[model samples]
Target: MQKSFLIVVIVAIVGGLAIHQFVPALSASIAFFAGAIIAALLFKLLPSALSQGDGEYSGPMMTLYVGNLPYRVHEGEVKELFSQYGEVCSVRLVRDRKTGRRKGFGFVEMPEASAQQAMAQLNDFVFQERTIKVREAKTQDSDSTEKNPV
Candidate 1:
């Protein structure tokens, strides 16, 4: 897919150059607009469009600590619940590494305003027979790299 898009972009650029040889003024304007569009896509659109992995997100966002989640509740369900308030950037349910069991808590990432709203509404809200808690995630002083420090 990317290869195809690249091919199209190259073709457009080549065609624009050919047009420039025939009509310099018209093609200069066209080239200017085309460059702007390409620059916008590359600098603005591309990063956000492709930032779907792990903890990647664009714009101002907040991470909420969602506690007391039902062990059986799916990530999609949590995402749906938060999406009602605002766009959910990501939902990550913490799990035990050894047994792969959900730890009954998770982190939800969303826009700052949306997170505040969700924290207001969802905290202490009952879902799946559990009263959950939602609040701004406390930033830890330690990072993963030091987990197995010798």
Candidate 2:
């Protein structure tokens, strides 16, 4: 049993070295496959492992609130401006329900990773002659009016 184990280890080492030296692409392919398998395993196992503690934790997609927009700046303009940073999912410019006029504020939705970068770069950015305020959007429940009663 001991001899067989030793022989197997020696054969694996020699075969790995041979593959690395003679067929470098094959070694890279093996590494890619191994990495993919590990990633798949982690994806399958990590959420359940993490949820055992308190509650299931999931990261929220990034949504940015953009304020002080020039009234002329529409959804297309906002989308165009943000697309420079990343893939913009949607742009919603707030409008008055009665008058159908822009309210100078809007929300922009993007993937989490790109949204962070965009927020950092675009906050207080001068667009259409106005310094726009860009930051993570607050949900309705978190709005100050709910906490402070008049």
Model 2: per-residue lDDT, tens digit, 6-110? 444454555556555776777655744554555445545664543354432245578899999999887999999998988788899999999999999999998
lDDT of 2 at 46: 66
Count of backbone clashes for each model?
0, 0
List pairs with backbone clashes in candidate 2. none
At residue 13, give the lDDT of candidate 1.
70
Q: Candidate 2: minimum summed lDDT over ten consecutive residues — where? A: 49-58
lDDT of 1: 0.81
CA lDDT of each prediction against the hidden true structure: 0.81, 0.77
Error of 1 at 35 (Å): 16
- What TM-scores do the predictions have? 0.60, 0.57
